[model samples]
Target chain A: MTAVAVNNIVKTYGKKKEVAALYDISFEVPQGELFGVIGPDGAGKTSLFRILTTLLLADSGSATVDGFDVVKDYKAIRKRVGYMPGKFSLYPDLSVEENLNFFATIFNTSIEENYELIKDIYIQIEPFKKRKAGKLSGGMKQKLALSCALIHRPSVLFLDEPTTGVDAVSRKEFWEMLKGLKQQGITILVSTPYMDEAGLCDRVALVQNGKILSINTPQGVVQEFPYPLWAIRSDKMLALQREAAKLSSVQDIYPFGEYHHVVLKKGSTAAQLEEFIQAHQVDNAEMKTATPDIEDCFIALMKPSIDTATDSLNENASK
Target chain B: MRTLKFLLQKEFRQIFRDPSILRIILVMPVIQLLILPWAADYEMKNIKLAVVDQDHSEYSRQLINKITSSGYFTLTSYSGSWEQSLEQVERDKADLILQIPLHFEQQLVKEDEAALFMAINAINGVKAGLGGAYLQRIIGEYNREVRMKWIQFPRFNPDTQIEVTSSNWFNPLMNYKYFMVPGILVILLTMVGTNLSAINIVREKEIGTIEQINVTPIKKYHFVLGKLIPFWILGLVVLTIGLTISRLFYGIIPAGSFITIYIFAAVYLLAVLGLGLLISTHSANQQQAMLLSFFLMMIFILLGGLYTSIDSMPEWAKWITRFNPVSYFIEVMRMVILKGSTLVDIKMHLLIMCGFAVGLNGWAVWSYRKRS
Candidate 1:
């Protein structure tokens, strides 16, 4: 069963300027699937979550959560879906227990009724249940927010950038909690700017500039990169990057931590790039075939669109 | 119903947990009630009098003595010429100048009437008007005294003299505090009901909690009521404290039944809080809500007949008071607390307030969209 299905959702803001936040976006989340909308800030991830959760109306398109239309059956969808906005939206002055209980009661359910569902996440923050939510540290706040979102045992959960400001450890723990919820057959749609978090999802839609770049399983997205990719390491990494971009065969070049993950043109070999790097007198450069990850795939998919976007912008600016 | 209960629980918990809200709820009424009634006293006193005693006769001295001892005027400048006293008026030192003419005693005895020229600085209109009225009353008293001493055994010429005896009925002592306390209490209730509820929703908007609530299955009326009921209760709580302070400090017991006041107060809070929620629906943040609330409050409190009588206001201002909710509550408070007006007497006001309650709350609920 499809837990969430969005069809050509287009949303724009500002009546005069009409900046489109989402444009012809289409996707679906299957039942019990942990879906991720991976994008950087201002990429319309929050806008998509708000529209699906029925807090916002899309300019043009139809969406359904749990088989209920987002616009037509909003009330029914509201009952079945749990939404955690990008910002921490819980009452900061209420204590942890109060915040959790408050959400439970509004949904006409009690904490004891769904104790098993939120028990793991709740137990972590239960010790500080008396403390005000605003006083909690970043990780504890994220955990409390998740607990509040889950108190009603919603069938479809929408978490928009839940781990945005959280530390590394808490981010991992949060994903683990999402995994556990998915096991209980709750369809979760979570958005994040962190590309690494995409690997943990059952499927991800790489979103940029109000459109989806790709939607596939983690391995499928990486496997779909139809190019010979090379990771070149050298003492003079900056010089190597400048030199590698000059090569006729290099398709894309971006610095990825210790190595620059370089994509070569179709039918190009790694040896051609190596000879070019050596000829440039780049110090101690070593090249090897590198496995593409989601970040590499995201950049490869996003770069060409970005170039065209700038090209159109230049055209408009000249006019 | 259960959603409303949970929302109210959360609202009250938040209100109690934030010390700033508690301070506003507790401290505002106590300070405004205990202090404003005393400070807002409208019985003008300390009128600076510059007396130019040109006559310096026995009658002029007696008249000056009477005016100074009337407890209203302080003899600020006593000089020979009216010009010197005029200088006092120019310097802003004197509010009224009383000039006793030459041969004033002889002219009074021979002609049985005397002309006194008085120059009143008309700046600060209220002070000047009251000061002139006070001086005239004192001189009239002195005239009556002289008439009594000079007349024969028949104390009054009943046929010729027509004396108008006027007495204050409600609030017989004419205590300014008695009148001001009830009006101040109404104002305190208004601030608590309007500003608090206005800021409460916008605070949620600013902090992003309203989005979470918007996505819930909660009904719109339930959400608005959850915001309304607690502050409505808090407004009544503020009224209770204000009434207690008025009774304890100013010795003002309501002439009417407390039940009538509470009944009216309950309905009044609904209209005010509905207006607040309406503002919150338009506002995007706490600052916008606060500014809008303050702007409305300034207009409401000023034209609400708290400082000035509505009947005495100009035609345009009277129309504003007709629409102002604060004016109705202030009038109702004074009517019940001073005149012992029963619910039947204020039935029109009660009916209008009900209209306001229904209209404003209905409009608020209609405008508050759960989705945007």
Candidate 2:
């Protein structure tokens, strides 16, 4: 059975009319699978996680966690699922031990019963157990939150933007902890805006503007980039970007650290691109055929959807 | 039941972990209860009086002495002109002016009557009114004495005398502290109960911890109860401290048994804490919750008859006090402590408070949405 399933979920906020925060969002996580939702801020990732965890209700859709309906069997689902919100939300004044004990007791379980599940993460922060959560570092706080979320031995865990603001080392260690949890057969659905983290997930759904742009394995998403891409570099990257945009054969130009990923117009070859760069008086320009990564795919998928939304908005204003 | 216990444990830990909240809950009430009663005293005394005696006759002088000796008035100015005396009132140095006409003694002997005028600074209306009444009583006594000496009436006569002797019950000396201490105790309890719980829940929302609790399996009633019980316990502690202060400093012992006061207080705390939770559930942040709670508490304390009598309030205000839970508790506290009222004696108040407890808390729990 699928550990979690969502069908045709739609959510809108505001009172008088509405603003769509999520539109027809649907996905399924197979039992013991790790799924990631990749999106920027305000991409409705938190709203989706809230709906799936039964903390909010979708306007017109259905979801089930561990075979329990999101609306009807909310009690059972709440017991079986763990939710760590986008914000670090444990009681700030409470000591680490107190926070862990509180969450465990609320779930009708004791720390002794679920000690093994959180032992790996908890051991690292054990020396700071007596300190208040507000006094802990960002990484320690995240670990403590994860420990509290998992103290009940939940079947599924939902983490929203868990590593949005942490040191690079902590973010890497946190992912390792998650991988360990996934190995124990717990379904984990995590969301992050970091494109590099997408490679770690078994599968990923790229979301933007409350819409799913694409869903596939990280490698699969990269493999499906429709256009032949090139990385172009010069001494003056900004000036190079401006001059390259003026090229008639250039389809698109996006700055990716130390280079720009340029898609050529149809029937435009690399020899023509080099000739255009030379003709534009660009010095020592280097160009190479490049493989499209998830970042390239994300920008490629996001641009047109934004254009269509803006087009509709303009269309509405004209009326 | 077990869920409630665990939730309450979490709540208590959070409440005690903060030193500031501990001071507010445990120490602030003791200081307020100790100090507030002294400021809230309503007895009017030491009223400054200015006598404008133009006649300078025996009757006028006698009246001036009687007024000055009444212990309620202090002679601030004794002038011959109304303008001089009015200046004293203008400077706020005198609260009342006793103006005697030029022919005051001559009129009493020839016309068999005399008229005296009083001008009072009514800005502090309560003080002015009480001072005027006290002066009037002293003048009445002087009139009777003069009448007895002037008209030599026989001790035995055909006329029958009907005298009215009044006695005070509950508070023989009419000590304002006796009335104010219990009422202030009620206000203290309401403040600690409402403001604390209101801020408590909204702090969770502001800090984003409420979302973590919302995703748990805890029932809404259990959450509300968990939030309420800790503050409810704190409120009772405040009440006990207030009562102890009243007893130790002011020598106030409840005329009724302690059980009656606690029984009423427990129910009152439920209603008040329920109100706090209601405000918190509706507010999105701590500032809104604090402002909303302040607005409601101002209305509650004013209409609760802490400083004024409900009977003297306008009809509409009295109607509002009927719905005010603080008013009921204040009245119950006064009745139980001052008047020695038992449970049976205050059954109506107890029932109304219980109704408020059930109705307000039921609405609060219903309005608290776990899935919002």
Candidate 3:
């Protein structure tokens, strides 16, 4: 069975005329799969997690986790789901072990019962278990918070922005621990604003402006890009981009990093691209074909989907 | 029932885990128990006086001695004349100025009335009223001597020997400490325990722990009630200790039933702790909770009738005081300790306190969020 099944979920704040926070959101996660909702701030990732965890009610939709309806079986759902909110919410005055013990006790369980699940994460900061949770380092706090969430041996784990402010090393270590949890067959839904973390998920839902743009494996999303792309670079990059945009051969010109990656119009050659740069009085220019990664896919996906739908129709009809 | 036990245990652990909460709980109560009553009082003390004895006769000297010997007065100076005595009181150098007038012993030889004039500061009506009472008592004692001399003839003085008598009940002295200590103890306990539980959740909300709890499977009521239970018990502990210290050390025993006093105290703690939880649920951060609590506590203590009797309040205000849970507890506690009142007598008070507890707790639990 799917670990989580959310169909047509909706939650809105403010008056009816105000912005709808989550508009008809839907998704499903197979048991044990590591899922990620990758988006910027206000993208409704946290809102969806809230609804799924039963902390919030959808205005007009249905959602369930591990066969328990979020609305009707809220208490049962709370028992089965582990949620690490975007902020460090554990008791600050309690020692690390006390915070852990407190959460464990709340669920009517103990640390001994589910020691193995959180053992790896808990052991790292076990030496400082007597120190106040408030006084712990950010990374240690994250570790302690995670252990608190997992203490009940939940079937589904929801970590909202788990790697937001920690150091790169800790963020890397945290994800490694998450992978181990997934290996234990626990479904995980993690959210992050960092696009780079998208690649680490088994599947990612790219969201923007409170709406899901695409949901697929990271590599699969990248593979959906249709056109061959070229990175066009020159010392006079601004002039090159303007000239490239005006060129009949160039279909799109957008800067990816240090260089503008251009798509050729239908069948334009690299020779034509070089000739155009020269015609534009560009100097010290370089051009190379580049593979589309998650970043490239994100940019392509962000573009208004109207043109892509036409292209998709042509591709489908051709097939 | 089991859920409540679990919640109660959780509240205690949370309170114990936070040293600040414990300090506020344990230390604040003791401080208030010890310090507040000392600053609070009703009796007037240290009235300044200027005495003018124009009749340097032995009769005038003895009368002056009677007034100065009283502990209530600090004789500022002996005025040279009645004019100077009036100047002394009007200039604020004296709270009261006394003049023993001289008829050159003529009034006494004829066995007529010897007059004493006293001028008093009445700017503060209460202080002035007390001053007037003290002056009257001292002059009355002097007049008793005057009246006794004429009594040898056994003539009619109609007012002479009216047989003065006074009976003071329970706390005849009514030491302010006895009244204040109990009220302060209740205030401190409520301030500490309720914040410990309620603020923990709000703090979590602020730092994001509440969001984490929201996504968890913990029942909302269990989580909330669990938090409230520990603080409630801690409040009980503080109250017990406060009662022990005051009763054992200060000899301020309650005249009412011991069981009734404690039961009322427990019921009242619920109202206070519930109030704290209610404030926490509505607040967004620890700071907001702390500030709002401090403000609410101030209003509860001041308006709670700890400083003055609520009965003296205007009719509308006296009615408003009925809603103050602290006032009910104070009234009940004083009645039980000072008057030795029965449970049947204070049943109405207990019922009102129960209403406060149940009402505030319901409001607190309702304001609390089960979801994001």
Candidate 4:
């Protein structure tokens, strides 16, 4: 079953003509699937989440969560869905237990009644249950917020950047909790700016500028990278990469921290690359192929279509 | 409804667990109830008085002694000149000064009606007005003394055939504490519903946790009702405590049904909490909600007949008070406590309060939006 169905969603904010937060976007998530929308800040990820959660009305499209229309059936849908926003959202003044109880009470359930679903996660912070949520460590706060969100065992959970600012250990634990939730057959739709986390999702959508650039499994999208990519290291990495870029055979050249991750023309021979490097006298230069990940595919797919279209067409044409 | 009950329990727990909030919610109102009435009385006493005795005569000396011996005035000093005496009053050193002219005794002996000047400070106009009347009563006594000793006149008292009667309502003790405690309960209940509830919701919006609530299967009404119910229950708890303090400290119990008061107050709390929710729904942050709710609170209390009697207010202000729920609560509380008024007897006030309770909540619910 399609757990979440968003069709041609558009969210335009403010009265001014230029403020279009979300352009036409559409996607679907199957039941029990962990779907992720990976994008940088201001990519309309939050706006899309708001629309799906029925917190906002879309300008010109329809969305349904668990087969309920986002707009019309908002009330019925609200009871079956859990949402954790991009920012920490709990009563900071209230203790962890108080916050948990307050949220549980709103859902007409007791923590003990639904303890099994939340026990593993809640127990981690139960020691600090008497401590104010505001004063807790970031990791503990995230856990408390998640436990509160899932206290009623909603069928589908919507997490908007749940791990935006926490230690790596907590972020890992949070995703693990999400995976544990998925095991219970809870459908999850999470959005984040972190690229590494994208690999953990069952399916991922690369979104930018209020548009989805690509939507596929992490490996599927990455395998579609149509280039011979090489991580080139040299004594003068910057100068070497710039000199390598002068060769017509080099398709794209960009620095990747200490070294440069360079792309070559499709189907170009390794012999074509060796001759060019020797001509440039790029001292102590080493070029070897590397596998493409979601970030690589994301950056490749996010390029203006006109720029990448010719190369994609040429790569397919030669095939 | 079950959710509401649970929310209410959570709210009570949170408020009780925080000692500082407990102090503000419970102890502070009791202190105000105990101390404020005594501090705010309109009755004037312990006045500082000076006499400018220009005439060095027995009658003037006797008059000065009489005025000094009066407990109302504490003959602070003797002024050498009229200007200095007037200056003393302007400086607020004396509440009043008696200016005795050079021929003051001669005029009193010869003239049937002699003018004795009593200059009173009138900053607090009502107290000043009453003080002048009190001084007149003392002067009348002095006149009777003078007439009886000098002329040997038969006293024909006007009160021989007339009947004077009066009775105090609600609080026969006339202890201002009795009146104030109920008023403080109203204030405390309003603070919980207005300040605390408003901040609570706005705090969620500020931190973005409202999104979590928004995405939950909990209905929007559930969300709004859940938040409001807890504060409403807290308001009731504070109300009960405040009422208990009033009864404990001053033995002032409401003559009306306590259950009826609680019921109406509970219904009225929906309106108060609704007001706070309306503020929270519109505000972007807790600070704005806190400030806006407090500002509205100040205006409501000022016009609520808490400090001033609505009946004594100007017609325009009286009309304004008609729309103020606080005014109705004050009137109903005073009526029930003082006159043993039944709900049926105070049906008009109850109707107005019910209407307000519905109207404010409607406004609150309608004003609440899904997003800021």
Candidate 5:
């Protein structure tokens, strides 16, 4: 069963109605599946989450959550779906326990009734349950928010960048909690800017500029990278990058941590690229064939559109 | 109904937990009630009189003595010439000048009438008007005394003069506190109700908690009612606190029943809180809501006939008072507290208040969107 189904959803903003926040976006979350919408900031991830949660309306097309239409049957969908906005939306003055109990009661259930559902997340923040939610640490606040979102035992959970501001350890713990929620037969549709978290989802829709570039499993997305990719490194990274851009065989080159992940054209090889870099007198330059991760696949799919956008901007600048 | 209960629980908990809200609820009323009435006195006093007595006769002396002894004027300057008294007014030494004309005693005895030219500094119009009226009344009384002494005892009253003895009804003492305390209490209730409820929903919007509630299965009316009820009760509590403070500190007991005041207040708060909630619906954040409330409140309180009588207001301002909720409450408070007006006397006010309550709240609920 499909927990969420969205088709051709488009949203626009601004006074003149010019900026498109979402452009013909379509995807689905299977029942009990851990689905992810992976994209960078302002990539329409939040917009999609808002539309599906019925906090916002789409300009066109339709969506449903747990078999209820988002626009037409919003009330029915609201009762069954749990949405944690990217921003922390719990009352800051209320204590953690009060926040949880408040959400539970509003949903017409008691904390005692939903104790089994939120117990795992609740236990983590239970020690500071008496403390105001605003006074809690970032990780603990997220935990309390998740607990409040789950207190009613919503069948379809929508968490928009829940781990956005969390620390490394807390991010890992949050994913672990999501996995646990999935085991209890809850379908989770989570969005994040971090490419690493994509692997954790059962499937991810790589979104960019209000459009979904690809929707597949982590490995499946990686396999969509269609060029021979190589990671090139040197002491003089900037000089090497400038020199490497001059090569006709290099399709794309962008700095990634200690190395620059470069995609070579179909007829080229890593050895030829290494030789070409050495000829540019870049010191201690090294090259190796690198497998594309979700990040690499994202960049590859995002490049053509970004180039066209930039090209049009340049065209306007020149005019 | 159950959803409303939870929302109310959360709202009350938040209201109590926030120190600023508690300060507004608890400390504001005590301080405003205890201090405002003492400062807001409207009775005019101590009008400076610069007397220029041209007629140095016994009657003129008696007149001067009577004017100074009336307790409304302080004889600031007694000068020889009209120019000197005019200088006193220019120098801000006197509020008004009393110029007694030459041959004043002779004119009164021979001509049976006297012409007194009074030059008044009309700046600070209320002070000038009241002072002029006070001095005129004392002079008129002195004329009556002189007439009584000249006329034969029993034959004086039967035919010549018609005396009008005026009596003040309701508040015979005309105690400004009796008039002021009820008005201030209305203002207190208005400020507390309008400001607190105005910020309640916008505070949620500012902190983004409204988004969470919007996504819930909670009904819009339930959400609006939850915000309204707690503040409505708090507003009544403020009215109660203000009434108690007035009774204890100022010795003011309303002539009418407390039940009447409470019934009006219950409806009055609905209108005011409805206004607040309406502002919250139109605003995007606390600051915007507060500024909007402040702007409207300044207009409401000033034109609400608390400080000034509605009958005395300009035609345009009077028209505004017809629509102003604060004006209606202040009018009701005065009518019930001072005049002991029954519910039937204020039935129109009650009906109009119900109109405000329903119209504002209906607009608020209609504008308050759960899905936007």
Candidate 6:
């Protein structure tokens, strides 16, 4: 059974000449599967989560959560779905236990009834249970919010950028908790800007500028890279990028940590490009043929959209 | 019902946990209730008077002495020249100038009547009007006394007389505090109900917890009721504290039954709290909610007849008061406390308050959207 199904959803904001926040977006998450909507900031991931959770109305389209219509059956969806928004949204003044109990009681359940679901996360924060949520560190607050979202044992969960601003260790622990929850057969839809987190999901839909660039498994997305990518490094990386942009065969150049990931045009060889750079009197430039990751594909996908946006902006400016 | 109960528990916990909010809810109203009534009194006293007595006769002297001894007027200046007395008025030393004509004691004996000119500063119209009327009453009494002495009539006199004795009801001493305390109490209740509830949901929005609550299965009316009930109870508690202070400090006991006052207060809080929720629903942040509540409160207090009589207001202002819930509560409070009016006496006000409670709460519930 599909836990969430969205089709042709479009949302726009502003008073005049509305700017589209989501444009004809369509995706689905199957039952008990951990699905990830991967994107950078302002990529409409939050908008999609809001629509699926029935907190906002889509301009045009239909969605369902746990087989209940988002609009027509919102009350039912609200009962069965759990949502932890992008921000830490639990009552900051409320203690950890109070926050947990409040959420449980509001859903017509008790803390004891769902103790098993949040027991793991709750135990870690139990020592500081009397502390206010605002006083907790980032990791503890994240866990408390997650526990609140899961208190009623929701069938489906929507977490929007759950791991953003969290330290590396907590982010890892949070995903481990999510994996454990997935083992209990809870369908999860999580959005994150971290490209590394994308690999942990069973399936991910790469979103950009209110449109989905691609939807595939982690290996499939990396397998579909059509370019012979190369990682090139030199003492002066900025100068290297500037010089490489002048080459006719270089399609894109982006800085990735110590090396710059370069995508060449069709029919261009990395060996040919390496020898060509060596002949240019560049100082100790090193090059190697590299396998493309999700970040590479994400950047590659983002280029055309950015280009089209600027082109339309130019067209409108000329008029 | 269970959802509402849980929501109320959360609300109460949040309310009582914060020290600042507790101070605002409990301590602030008591302080305001104690201090406001003494400052809000409208009874005018200590009118400064300057008498320009050009007539040196015993009758003129008697009139001047009567004016000075009326207890409402203080003789600030005694001068024979009207110009000097007018100078005292100009210097702000006198509020009223009495100009007695220069008759040398012959005009009143020869002619049956004498004319006197009284000049008063009318800047504060209420004080001026009341002072003029008080002086006129004292002069009228003196005239009657003089006429009775001159007549020396037998028991078979031809003239018919009617003596009028007037008494002030409800507040026989005409204590302004008796009237002002209840009005100030209504205002305090309104401040608690309107301002605090206005900030309630908006604060959740600011802190982003509203998003979590909105995504739940709790009904809209349940959410609104949960938000309202805590403040409603707090409002009653504040009213009770205010009533206790009024009795202890000001020695005011309500003429009507406690049941009637509590009943009206309960319904009035519903209307005011519904207004607060309506404002919060329309606002995007706590600042906007605060500003809108303040704007509405100014209108409610001014038109609610707290310090002024609604009957004496302009026709349009009077019309506006008809729809003001605060005005209805103030009116009901005064009628019940001062006049000992029964529920039947305030049935119209109660019905209008019921309409306000229904309409505002319904609008609040309808305007609160889980989806935008």
Per-prediction TM-score, please?
A: 0.92, 0.94, 0.83, 0.82, 0.91, 0.90
Q: Chain B vs. true chain B: TM-score for each candidate?
A: 0.96, 0.95, 0.84, 0.88, 0.92, 0.91
Could you report the DockQ of all the candidates, in the order they appear? 0.74, 0.70, 0.48, 0.49, 0.71, 0.72
TM-score of 2: 0.94
Candidate 3's DockQ is 0.48
Colliding residue pairs in candidate 4: A78-B216, A78-B217, A79-B217, A89-B209, B170-B338
lDDT for residue A30 in candidate 3, whole number 0-100: 94
Task: lDDT winner between 3 and 6, please give it.
Answer: 6
Best of the two (4, 6) by TM-score = 6
Q: CA lDDT of each candidate?
A: 0.89, 0.89, 0.79, 0.79, 0.88, 0.89
lDDT by residue for model 2 over B7-45, one digit each (tens)? 888888888778889899778878887888888767677
Instruction: Say what the RMSD of model 1 is.
Output: 4.0
- The best candidate in terms of DockQ: 1
Candidate 3 residue spans exceeding 4 A from truth? A15-17, A119-132, A234-273, A276-283, A303-319, B1-14, B48-69, B73-125, B132-153, B156-163, B193-197, B255-257
Model 2 stretches with alpha carbons more than 4 Å out? A279-283, A305-319, B84-91, B155-161
lDDT of 5: 0.88
Summed backbone clashes in each candidate are 0, 0, 15, 5, 0, 0
lDDT of 2 by residue, A177-201 (tens): 9999999999999999999999999
lDDT of 5 by residue, A1-319 (tens): 9999998999999888799999998778889999999999999999999999998999999998999999999999889999999999898888988888889898999899989888888898888889999999999999999999998889999999999999999999999999999999999999999999999999998888898777888987776567798998888899888878778788889999999988887566677686776775547778878989988877777777345433433333223
**How high is each candidate's interface RMSD, in Å?**
1.0, 1.1, 2.6, 2.4, 1.0, 0.8
Candidate 6 at residue B342, lDDT?
Answer: 90
TM-score, chain A, candidate 2: 0.93
Task: Report the C-alpha lDDT of model 4 over B208-298, residue by residue, as the tens digit.
Answer: 7677666655556767777776677678888887788778877787888887687678777877887888888888897788789878888
> How well does candidate 2 score on lDDT at residue B95?
95
Give the TM-score comparing model 4 with the true structure, all chains together: 0.82
Better of 3 and 6 by TM-score: 6
Quote model 1's TM-score.
0.92
lDDT of 4 by residue, A101-177 (tens): 88887777889999999999999999888899999998898898889889888988988888899889889988998
